[model samples]
Target chain A: MWTWFYQLASPKWFYQFSNKLLPWFRAATFILFAAGLALGLLFSPLDYQQGNTVRILYIHVPAAFLSMFVYVLMALSGGIGFIWRIKMAHIVSVSCAPIGAIFTLLALITGAIWGKPTWGTYWVWDARLTSFLILLFLYLGFMALHNAFDDRKTADRAAAILALVGLVNIPIIHFSVEWWNSLHQGATISKFEKPSMDADMLKALLTMIVAFQVYFVTVLLQRVKAEILLREKLSGWVKKLVTNQ
Target chain B: MYFQSFKEFIEMGGHGFYVWLCYGVVLSGLVSYFIYSKQLAKRNQRNLIKFYKRMDARSQLNANNQLNANNEAQ
Candidate 1:
């Protein structure tokens, strides 16, 4: 098991392993997204209160979930890299930044759109919304800090530290709805109890969440491969791989 | 199935604008990221190949120069 973990930490091994996994992830993402969309937009009944405007939930919920999920993933990868000095962990952390940022942006935009009809407003500075915005800025800050340093190792360390520090905001974002009397609604799916959603609606949301997660993996693999090639440009394996390509 | 016809579905019971816009933006963002990452990988490969080719050519030139200098000494 330790050997497997070390092998995964190796850039060359990761590159090869990811190459095999990417196609499957791509296929699953496509299938899940298609089914989720069909069910979410057409098959599932509209919310009795919000009507068709609730359709935005399909996209909004997944994007919001992924925004926080990716941040936590980034923070964990960054922590591993910091403690273990694993170059692959740093690469994975960096690869997740842009993807997380995009998801955060999507969540914000979709949330705003959904809010207009429901809350009669497009923007709100409530706890949930505000913390989520801060999360986005943290992602952007990580990317910017990573790029600012001329030395790769220094940049990685700096960005990893930032990610770890930003981990505090993740919990805040997750519990903001419960902790504060904000306009943002409470959780529909609780860990301790049954979800407060219809079966089909829950199915569609769950499927979309899976689709987004798979899509993140697929893209992360591609991004990590590119990062490896760039960072290991002079390495024998990279040279041979590039030549063969 | 929720809507009566294609028109109703498109209209999304009068909330079509928000619904479609949200989906459209998210889809576009995802697709663009996918395309961008693929292109970046291709570019990285090309850059690596080009760097190696240049290094190989320079080494070959140095070897040729050394051979000429050896011939001169002989």
Candidate 2:
């Protein structure tokens, strides 16, 4: 197990493997994203009241879900890197921050847009939105902490600790709707019951969610590859690779 | 198939501004990332070539100087 983990941490190995996997993710993202957009816009029936504005949910819901999901992933990656001192884990955890932050912002923006039409207001102190805003702040804090230290290792460790500590907000963000009588609507989709949504709407949302997942993997891989190259630039393999290229 | 025209698509049922803004932002973000990653790859490659060239040139200069010394000794 340890040996396998070390192999994954190896920059040369990761670079080689990711090179092969990038194309698959690229194709997956393109196809799935297109399908989601088509289904959401053309195939799905309009809402009785909200009309076309409800289409925003296709983007908003998935992005919000991914925002939290990516944070958890980042925190877990950080925890692994901190425990095992794996360089690749640190690279992944750190690279995920900006991407996760952007998605968090998107979720908030789209939510506000959805809110304006549905709730007749753009801003609210609702629990779900408030917690997500905090999640965004957490991402910013992690990015700032990572860049503050001169030493790369210290920066990684400090950011890792912050990420791990911030993982507590994930659940709070999820359950906020239930925990408080909030302005935000209850989930349309949940595990405990069948989704309370049109089948086409559910299909579109799921497609978009999968697209978001693929997009995250694709971007995270790109960022991690750049970090790996920079950190391993001094190695003999890097020298040969650079010269050969 | 959804909206009647590109014009109506832009209108987006009078919520066009918000809808288009969100779409524009998402599109721009994706485009920027693609451009940034491509530029990064190109820059890295260029720098690596320059570094290798400098190393090779320095090694050649040292070898030629060593040869000159050997000739003088001879």
Candidate 3:
């Protein structure tokens, strides 16, 4: 078990494993995105009140979901790396920052676009929106911290600590709607009891969410694989693979 | 399917601009990010290959110079 764990931690092992998985991930991401897009745009019923503006939820919700999800992963891995000094874990933290930032940006942009149609305005400094914007800043801060240090280990450690500290804001973002009188709607699928939505709409939303998650994993692997190679460039195995390929 | 035809679907009940704009931006952003990550990996690989080639050439040159030095001493 320990040997297996070590192997899992090994960058070389991860690189080879991801190489095998990349083709499959790419195919699945494409297929799922296509299905999600079709279902979201064509099949899902229009909202009675918001009409076509409801379609924005399909994109906005998934981006919002991924924004939070990626941050959790980033912070958790960063915490793990900071605590244990696992170099590969640091790589995971490093790779997750930019991806999380982009997801946050997507969520903010789509939410603003969605807002313009429903709320009659494009921007508001509401609590949920404000906290979410903070999430984006946190991601930027993490990346910026990572870049500031000339030393790899120090940079990773500093960024990891910042991520852990920012984990406090996650709950604030999640509950901001309830805590403050905000324009943002409460979650459609809250706490796994049942989605307070039509089955068809829920289906489309779930498909898109899963598709986005799969897409995230695919891209994350792409980045991690690249990071592993760059870090392992001096290793014999990487050299052999590089020259042979 | 929800709409009667392609035009209605595209129009999206007068909210077409927002819906289409959001979708277009998000999809294009996602695609561009994927492409960017792929390129980053490829660039690093190219750099590694170049690094190895440079190292190999320098070592070969050193070996050749050593052989000449040894022969001249002999």
Candidate 4:
């Protein structure tokens, strides 16, 4: 098991492994997204209260979930890299930032759009919304700090530290609705015992979540492969691969 | 099939603007990111190949210069 872990830590090993895994992720992402969108937008029953506006939930919920999910992933990867001194872990941590940032932006934009019809306003300073905005800023900060340093190792260490420090905001974002009198709705799908959502609605939301997760993996693999090639440009394997190309 | 007709589906019962806008932006973002990352990878690969070819050519030139000096000495 430890040998497997160490092998996975190797950039060359991961590069090859991800190459094999990416195509499957790509296929799954496409299928899930198509199915989810069709089910949510057309097949799922309309909400009694929100009507068609609730269709925005299909996109909003998944993007919001991924925003926080990717943050946790980034923080964990950063922690592993910092503790274990694994170069691949550092590469993964950095690669996750841009993608996470994009999700966070999507979440915020869709949330605001969903808000306009539901809350009669596009902007709010509610706890859930505010903390989510901060989450976006945290991602931006990590990316900015990563690029600030002249040395790669120094930049990686600094950005990893920022990610770890920002981990507190994830819990805040998750529990904000419960902790405060926020306009945003509380947990619906996350309640494993008895979710509040209808069956088809729940299915569509879950499918979209899976689709986003797979999309994240697919893109992260591509980004990490590029990072490896650039960082290991002079290494024997990369050199040979480039020469062959 | 929730909507009775194509028009109703497109209209989304008068909330079409919001629903379509949200999905449209999200999809565009995802697709663009995928395309951008793939382009970045392809460009990096091209650059790496070019770099190695240049390095190899320079090394070959040095080897040729060394061989000529050796011939002069002989």
Top TM-score hit: 1
Query: What does the lDDT read for residue A129 in candidate 1?
Result: 93
DockQ of each: 0.75, 0.33, 0.73, 0.70
RMSD, candidate 1, Å = 1.9
Where is model 2 more than 4 Å wrong at Cα?
A: A1-6, B1-10, B48-74
The share of true interface contacts that also appear in candidate 3 amounts to: 0.77
Model 2 per-residue lDDT at A8: 82
The superposed Cα distance between candidate 2 and the true structure at residue A181, in angstroms, equals 2.1
Off by over 4 Å in 4: B57-74
Off by over 4 Å in 3: A1-4, B56-74
Residues A73-128 of candidate 1: C-alpha lDDT, one tens digit per residue:
99899989989899999999999999999999999999999999899999989999
Select the stronger candidate by DockQ from 1 and 4. Answer: 1
Candidate 4 lDDT, A1-245, residue by residue in tens: 58977899898999899889988988988999999999899889999999999989888889988888999999999999999889998999999999999999999999998889889999989999999999999999999999999999999999999999999999898899999999998888655668888999998888889889999999999999899999989899999887775
Worst 10 contiguous positions by lDDT, candidate 1 chain A: A1-10
**Once model 2 is optimally superposed onto the true structure by TM-score, how far is the C-alpha of residue A227 displaced, in angstroms?**
0.8
lDDT of 3 by residue, A181-233 (tens): 99988888987687888777888899999999988988999899889888888
Deviation in angstroms for B72 in model 1? 11
